[model samples]
Target: MSEKIEPTAAIEGAAPGAALSPAAQRALEEAAARRKAATAAPAPAEKGGPSGPEPTRYGDWERKGRAVDF
Candidate 1:
């Protein structure tokens, strides 16, 4: 059996052209600055190989330079 779905209520301060309080504006600016700074920072260089032994196939394991099977 199908049931009727009710419409969701609108969120406060989420409408287009809505004005935000000074505190809320400051918080949004700070969050945006932090995001920009995080993205501007350089990422660490990746190592050459896997950090630990990983399963390659069913019942098989592979490490830096060796493979084991059972």
Candidate 2:
């Protein structure tokens, strides 16, 4: 079956930042600054593997046959 497609209303030729209120603009700026700082910061160094074998709680898994009889 074919479906009808509808056009969506989109605002063009507008500065996206112009839609933000003063508080929202300030928050956006703060978030951008935090993101920039995070990108600029050095990443943590990787560590070696564990010294000993780790324990697990897993058990043997089996699938039982159906209970129906002929």
Candidate 3:
């Protein structure tokens, strides 16, 4: 099988003083926004799961690793 590439392969491909193109920058921003939006939704629970009261505040659930109420 072919061997893995070195980490510096991409750095070697670009010109010494080159900067990211506008198209490339825009693509990166779009990808980041999509990722954020996708993860912003609450996770779905299975049937007959622990259904309970809504959280009072975000920081309350977030303080614990799981978004669950104690």
Q: Evaluated with lDDT, which candidate comes out highest?
A: 1
Order of the predicted models by TM-score, top scorer first: 1, 2, 3
What is the per-residue lDDT of model 2 for residues 1-70, given as tens digits with 9 covering 90 to 100? 2544233222232244355444555566677778889999999855762244421213323224323232
Compose the digit string of candidate 3's lDDT tens values, residues 1-70.
2543232213323444456565554565677678788989888776854347544444456423566556
lDDT per residue (tens digit) for residues 1-70 in model 1: 2544333233233344555555555566677678889999999866874555545645557665686565
- Candidate RMSDs in order: 12.5, 16.5, 11.7
User: Where does candidate 1 stray beyond 4 Å?
Assistant: 1-16, 47-70
> Model 3 Cα displacement at 34 (Å)?
1.1
TM-score of each: 0.46, 0.42, 0.39
TM-score between candidate 1 and the true structure: 0.46
RMSD of 1: 12.5
